[model samples]
Target: MKTQNQITVTQIETIEQFESLREEWNALLFQCVEKDVFLTWEWQFAWWKNIGQWEYQLWILLFHEDEQLIGIAPLMMSQKRKFRFHFRWLENIGNPECDVSTIISIEPQKTISALLRYLQEKRQEWDGLELMEVNATTTGNQEILKTLEDSHYGFWRTKEEHFYIPLMGNTWEEYYNQLSKNMKHNLKRRMKRIAEMGTVSFKKYSGNSLTWQDFQTMCKVSEKSNFPDLYKSDNLLSFHKDLLEFMRELGWVQIEMLFIDERPIAFQYGFLFDNKYEDWRGGIDKEFETLAPGKLLMVFSLEERFKLGLRESDFLRGVYSYKTDWNPLSREFTNIQVYNTSNIKSKLAYWWVKHLKPIVESLLSKEKQKEQQNDSS
Candidate 1:
């Protein structure tokens, strides 16, 4: 056992360097209290390979207590120009892609103290740090925030909504029964309609069962979905291809497809990690619109997870209002963009963003509303 002060920090800035930490990275994640699929080495690496590499450079910080890895910062850096000012900033990997990211540590306070000290020590390297999609509900993350506050790192946060269904030992039957009468009726009706078309079945791919062909088939279905443009970009498709290939190798890919006889209509792609099912992306064939394949598959997927002994179904972050129908509990993720307190310009920018910007926006919005009212008259 190593004391907190003895914990050593190292920086990993190259892909080759990152590849070496896979086993250790995941092992440390397994020991964390707030483990999620998004924080996995594969997910972060995949996101960086496809998205971050074009602009951002890796700045991952790893903390070790003599040879045993204890915590990971999972951060990256990019030189950015905004509002006509050039500056550098660091952020957690998997931005906009992962639902949330948090500090991976067994000891939150000790790890955060070490992390903050390191950041301040190297303040010249970055003018700010934007830690995105941090799960505010977890006590560990709360501790991280508190440590930053105590350290006097001037920080403010914005929030995003996350929704999930807590299955924590509840049977599918109980969950189904708990749905509102209208929802239950709609689900049954949709299921029955799809059943009438042909034999309804479910296909799941994970571990060794996943294949690129099967994954492409799902993408084809999404291409014709109500969210047709979701996979319209070759770049986005390429990212998923790389991400899925990496995640599948680790037995983390959890894909559930709803089929009618020989035809696939709806599919859900996500990771089943640490006993939770994250519903990353799912879509239905618009050809099956009348059958409501989207809703049918959603309920089926939930039940399938129940059978798999999964604990929660995270609907994740986005504007999917339909998730409310599942009676999912909700949480908020805090996105903190902290300035480098040592830099006067950075501190001023942070204060302006935290204070004056909102008021300015509010006034602009009111003027716009007044103009709209005059135009209507």
Candidate 2:
């Protein structure tokens, strides 16, 4: 273990170093009380194995206090062509399958300060650090951003609405009562109707007993039901397969399958890590839409998660109205993009796009409206 006085930041270049740092890194992250699956080694390593080759470089920043690991920042370096010079950027390595990205550790305040200091000193070697898709609502992230601001790093925010349903020690009756009257009525009606169809049941499976066929079936239902475009991409399919395999190996995969008369009608793919169950994906058999299998699946999944002793169940990133029936506390995530101040041309281009794109889109929308009106006349 290295003390703060003798702290060293080394680029993680070999698989051995990455594996060796895993225990310490995870220890620090869990100590912070963060509950996202993206921070898990199962998720990150699967991402690295599947997609890290696409990036220019990958680096893991480790901080130690008296020879004990205190914090870590898993980053990937990439180069993008700018107007003058090629700009290098460091970001939380992410892919389509992942939901959120940010620096993860227990002591974010201290770790972020050190990270900013290192980046400022090495500014000559690169353009700037770009922390993308951070959950701005998280207290630790707000502190990290404050540290960056104090260090003279320019940052901007783009808002994102994440959907979730909270479950802690509340009974199902209490949860349902909190919903709006109309929503409550609708949900109760849906569940009752589904129950009338046949024996409706929900089962959650994790651990090594789960089979690959179960995973493939869930993927197939997802593609056949909501957003076929997601599975259309070869990269996304490969990433999903690798992630499932990795999670299964680590016993982090939490699957909820809703059945009517023992026939699977809906399923949810969630990851149980860091004491939280993140609902990563869901699919329903359109044939069973009238039975409201989707809602049944979610309700059952929530109960199942609670039974497993999980703290929170996140619906991840969509704001569909149906999710509100569970009465979750809404939170906003943000996207932060930073550019090098030294590159004036790149700055100008970025400003133009940022400030002018909305106006251009609005004008085009009006023009289309006028054309539609003229054709009607």
Candidate 3:
């Protein structure tokens, strides 16, 4: 056990250095107040391997005390061009693919405060910061923003909504009854029509029992669906294949498939981690659209999750009418951007592009339209 006071920060610059910290990194994950699989070492490393562009430099921050790992800020630095200027900025490693972002540690306030002080001291190193998919409600990521603001860090933020289902009641039927009358009727109708098509069955693959053939089945279903291009990309397929394999070893991967007459029509790719089941992605066959196989599978999947006594079933990102129809709870997340005001170049760039440029462009557009109207008169 480590005494909390003697904390030291180490910057991980190379992949080998990052790899060396894996054992302690994962151990810290379970000890954190918030359990997010996105912050896991495997997910972070996999994202870097498959999707991270070559130009970005790794700057993962590791916080330790007496040889025991306490916190991590899995970050990277890159330069971006915006409105005639290029500036360097830091951000969490997982982007575009990751939904929940935060400093992975037990005492978030203490960890973030120290990290901020470190950043403030080394302010010349970067131009700004942009962290996305921060669950402002849970994770206490607001602390990061607050700490920055208190230190006069120039930043902006925007929020988006994420939804989830909280399974209630001891029985699946009881939980089913809580849905709106319209939803209940729709589910009953879909189930009946699907049943009439042929023998209907649902299967779930988890752990090492999952195979590449199962992935191919899921891709085939996605290919035949409304989103035909969803699974068409080789890179995405490879990323998912690699991620699924990685997650399986940790016993966090789960895939659900609905078959009619032994033919796969709908499939769901999800993760069951730490008693929370996340309905990550799924696809449906267009030929079975009339039978509503997708909806049927979703209902079965939710029921299955409820039977397993999971704490919550998350719909993940993107708000849709169907997600709302399920009548689940919601969480709001924000994207935070912090400018390095201490650096003259970054300060000028931030103020010019983010503040002055937008207002100037809007006024200029309005004036141009006015001139045309006056000439017509």
Candidate 4:
């Protein structure tokens, strides 16, 4: 680590460098105020190896205090041409994929200052930054955003919310009884419908116990569910396969299947890490849609987690009545896009993201709506 001032900044730009920092990376993770399962080394490494490397360049940064690691910003940069405009921008490793993200730092101000100053100096390499899934509750990120606001080089967009249920050793029955009346009624009615069809059962595989066949079975059902986009691509499918293998060895993999009459009906897949269960992805068979097998699986999964005394149940990203019905708390995520003052390209890119693109998209959406109404009429 090279030191110019009190806080020294070093960057990890190679896969080999990332591979070597596994232990140190996780050790710093525990010190973060906004600790998240998605922010772990395993998740970032898996994403970078399988999907990100092909699309983005690694730009992960490390902030040090006289030889001791203080903070890390897991970032990547990508370039693209859209509508004849050539642009390059930086973003967090898990954009549109992983749910929650934040800098791994014990000293919020010191760490953030070093990182931003470093980025400010190297601004010529990238046009702008678009950080996603940053937890609003974390002070480290708040400091970073404050610095940006004061510097006049960045803008913070509208916040996005992610939901999680605080388990805290609560009994499953106690928690279930507290759900909204309508949710309880609906869940029970659907469950009864499922029970009438045949005997119901659930099977879970985790860590070394999870097999490729089990994951593929879940994938088959998920493809027919509401989230077909999650698996419709070969690259995305391969990404999950790779993630499954990497996570399984560390006892982080958690995939649970619900069955009726010995036929699989739903799959609830996620990770069990840091004593919290991250509910990442799930799907139910289209044939069992009428029975709402997904809700049943959610119920089973939550109950099982409570039984294990997990601290929290993260529903990940998205807002749905089904998740809301469980009475989970919402965590808002704020994103920022900052540009280099000296670079004209960076200013234009920032302007496009912060102003022009939204107006154009809104106009296009309204036009599409009008066309759809005409077709329907």
- List all candidate RMSDs to the true structure: 2.8, 3.7, 4.4, 3.0
Model 1 alpha-carbon drift over 4 Å, by segment: 1-4, 232-238, 364-377
Report the C-alpha lDDT of model 4 over 1-377, residue by residue, as the tens digit: 45456788888889999889889998998877777768888888878887898888998999889878888888898886744666677788977797876677888778777776777677667667777777777667788677766775756466788899999857899999998888899998998888989999999999888998898888778877877667767777777787787788888879999998778889988889888899888888898898888889988888989999999999877899778877999987776776665666666666777789899999999999999999999
Worst window of 10 by summed lDDT in candidate 1? 1-10
Model 4 is weakest, by summed lDDT over 10 consecutive residues, at: 80-89
Which residues of candidate 2, in runs, are more than 4 Å off?
1-6, 81-86, 192-198, 229-246, 306-309, 353-377
lDDT of 1 at 105: 93
Better of 1 and 4 by lDDT: 1
Q: To one decimal, what is the Cα RMSD in angstroms of model 2 from the true structure?
A: 3.7
lDDT order, best first, reads 1, 4, 3, 2
Q: For model 3, what is the error of residue 245's alpha carbon versus the real structure, in angstroms, after optimal superposition?
A: 2.4
**TM-score of each predicted structure versus truth:** 0.91, 0.83, 0.88, 0.89
Give one digit per residue, the lDDT tens place, for model 2 in 1-377.
22245555555765567656656666666676554678777677767766675665776777765566666778777776755667777777674446877777667776776776666556665565666557887788888777776655445567777776666777666766777897657667988888888988877778776776777767667766867565666666676677777678677887788887877888888777767787877888888777567877776776666666676777777778667667788778876665555556446645654687679999999999999999999
C-alpha lDDT of all candidate models, in order: 0.84, 0.71, 0.81, 0.82
Return model 4's CA RMSD, one decimal.
3.0
Give the number of the best model, judged by lDDT: 1
> Local error of candidate 1 at 331, Å?
2.3
Best by TM-score: 1
Ranking by TM-score: 1, 4, 3, 2
